[model samples]
Target: MSVTSAATGSGPSRWRAGLGRLAAGAALITAVASLPWLSGNDPALTVLRARSADQDPTPEQLTAVREQLGLDEGPFAHLAHWLGGLPRGDAGTSWVSGDAVLPQVTGAFAVSLTLMLGALAVTVAVAALACVRTLYLGSRRRLQRGRGAIGVAVLAALPKFLLASLLATVYGVWLGWLPSSGWQGPASMVLPSLALGVPSGAVIGGLLQQSLPAAFNEPWARTWHAYGFARGRVARHALRRALAGVLPQLLPTVVGLVGGAVAVEKIFNVPGLGRLALDAAIAQDLPPLQTATLSLILLGVAAGLLIQALRRALLGPALRDGALPALHAPAAARGRFTRWVVAVCALALLAVITAGLLRDPLHVDTAARLLPPSAAHPLGTDALGRDLLARLGHGASRTVALALVVTAVCALTGLLLGMTAQIGAGLTEVVSTMPAVLAGLLTTAVTGPSAWGAALAVCLVGWTPYAAQAAALLEQERASGHMLASLSFGAGPGYLLRHHLLPAVLPGVLRNALLRLPTTVLVLASLGFLGLGEQPPTAEWGRLLSENQPYVELAPWTVLGPACALVLLSVLALNGADAVAVRRRPASARTRPWSRGTGLRVKSGVSAG
Candidate 1:
């Protein structure tokens, strides 16, 4: 049976599993809900860390803060106290500011929701337009060249900060078309929207580009053309069909806007929950963190569920279950595959080189510590008096560098282990069934908090998913005619793997690696926020959040800078992944000269049968 048949047959089981999933989700949320009590660290110590004092907190001061905060009880006592308050309206107060967590979260939540909704609107509009444009352009063979792949690469790999900076310079400074960065009125939304929407558009366009070729070549489309239907009408019908194939790709990308919005909000100085969540995580304040997580999870889940429903309603679940064109290599375009090999290598090198150029962010000064945002100190000074902007840059560099390393490691591991049959299956089940977070938690427990350990933890947890993918790819291609032909030619297993299989596997592996990179960065940021990532003075994004969280009330930039950096890097990684994953060998490499024909499909692969 084919993959689609298996998927269709398993629908009943999927529905059953969804109920079990909902129950499990409730359980997970409940468990996370209790985190305020379960975090074994001393709340007073967390508060003290934020004091920014020249001298140690006197015993009297410590005792006073502890008594005032009621932290004198044992862990169980605190847990019991917090659980008891759950029956009523109270959740607790912020650890650092001593304000009501609910109020703070609600206010921040308002900002985040506004930004989220705006970004979502922008995403949808841009994505739809992008798909249409790509479809129209794709049908024009004269223009479909290496330029498209390069353009997609640049857009996908462009960091949110870079894009934000470009917008600020072009529109805000020079053209006076829009404000550089702010969230005062409706006008402020324009540039940020473009900043976010453009890359998302590129991703949407790439998805459409991938599947559009096949959709256009579907027998129905060819028949319409054969029947002498006008070109425009036939193109319209093919595009409509292509929409069903590509809309599903937008679901995950939309879910990812959470990270992108965080960066955009911080860059534009928009007060949003992305900033709030980072601060909460940094401060190790359970209530606000809990509130933010609960809200985001619920929102994300809802949006995802809504998109899933939309896919079924508009596209139908049978799109996957039905015979359709896949978003794989266009068999006619093998020459352009070499170009992607070059792009992949260049992208990796560019990341590492960028990491090397960032300035050290840990050099501190006592006098400038905790300064608010000023012209001189653009992102202000953290509690350690290190420049927040500098730290953010360095932290982003570090995060990307480590994530790249980890992604490479994961890809290689998956490729190697996926070659085995029994071992691959066992590992797949283990990785699929078990959560990466659990592995991260255990690795951090063993290694403690450091840069390399964080990388190790990420690799340990992240590899399984990649391995599962790699194993599946291997299985799919192993039975292909090319492999069978090579085997029948008496090609040794090693030669077949090295020449035939590896070439087939490498591009897919590269795509998967790119896809996994953003996820790696997010995981590292989360771990860093938990004090399990790179230590301060070394300046990781999560570490900056952890350190400056207490100062958020005094200098918002301290929190926003790192938060924006985190989100920007994530978006960059995600966009790059999406851009490259759907990338195909450019058809122009195989097409006849543009002057020869109408730049349309001259020698089509599948015909109207």
Candidate 2:
């Protein structure tokens, strides 16, 4: 096909995709904007309580407030009115403050955008460093690679809230090196930015670390080296190729960083969009919450579009050649050391669960309250004199079980949707933009706060990533030579799918789920910390952290036990993922079409294809 003709032919498809995204965004905005109606909360009463908590408004007062806020209209009419005003820069007036929602949302979004940008910069720097180290330093030793993978896993597994808390405690409270709370200046930005950025950086960096090595070993890279290309030049070129493989993940990671900023913003008291959304949800401030949700959706769409453009630009010639390198799991050695580490983490987790099951977590002794660790109470006592050890142990079951259930459901749902291509890309993008915390808030508004509600909230958006991954993997698999040959041989769809697609896609999807297990656990813990999960007097890890956080200084053990348990759980999940990835590596390496020994061979007078 001629270049101009091909471009013309692709125009309609591109336009259709853009329209689809726009429609998806509009639908998502409308759904989220309907939360006020869905929750069955009286807007006037909510606004009244938020505005003047001490005053008891009479029926006349309620009617007056409703009329003033235009709440007399039906939900659909109200939505139409809000949507109508949005384009003109009016986002309706906040029920609580009686101010325009646009300004409030924009101001908060600007703060959030700044934070997100700073965090993105951090992520890029980390990824670049990892790529450079892997490419130039030739750190291909299995032991070094395994250690690097493990370190990244640990860092990636740290929950935003826990990391924020630790940063505040050590840097802000203890060392006094940086301001812990508020957004005063660059100094204040350090802690929150690091808290938000580091885990994401670890994730992005790990992906680059894995990809760069594979790229370096590609036939093109080796051929370039043989042609007497400078080592640095070859490595730099390889970096670009490796990055193309990692670009698909960049959108989700970027969106996730913004979504995750909710907890970090709450912990650090940053006046960002996330914090605003959380506060509005808690107060049933629909106008502001709706605006925030809409803003987040738009951001996700924009990021996705931008990342797509960048990928195209990066793979300019390669796009035509269809020579993009596939990303593989890092080839970390599954040595005794790795096994030992995994074993220890597993044993510790098992012990915690078993010990917790046998203990009385609910037993509280006021007389023994705030006691330090001893033989009687090994993990010390909380303010209510509940044994920390007992609580940690018992909470393990609730937290771990719930996390497992959520992860399993998400993985299964994602796998089915992704494999079947049941979910549209636009819809997946829209749903992925909604943070777990925001989803939990919406669920809480509808069902009230409960563990079930929290789990439901997570399930709502948790499947998007897995679905996206699986769909992408399936698409790649279908485009492979073997699948094409099977189709050419008159193999039926059922046969090809049963004998080829399922076997090829299942392992990767499962591995993606295992990697996501820690994140699921963290999300549930975050909801509990925010009171959207298990109610008070219930032993849950997140609830424990929240309950004991205030008394952390006075009785460090109260918080330490649960905190350590969470960290340990994250480590275990990551190690398990590593093991799974490594186990599948050898098979993938042997089957991979483009290896170092057999590089792409461009024919004369034709393109790189």
**All candidates: TM-score:** 0.59, 0.87
Model 2 over residues 244-337: C-alpha lDDT tens digits?
6566567777787776577788878889988888888777787888888888888888886677578667657554443332344445545577
lDDT for predicted candidate 2 compared with the true structure: 0.71
Candidate 2 lDDT score at position 138 = 40
State the lDDT of candidate 1 residue by residue for 415-516, as single tens digits. Answer: 786565433434333233222333343454456667787788667645654554454445444544344444444656676566445654565567657744
Model 1, stretches more than 4 Å misplaced?
1-41, 48-55, 60-90, 124-133, 137-145, 166-182, 229-252, 259-263, 317-328, 332-405, 408-450, 453-512, 515-609
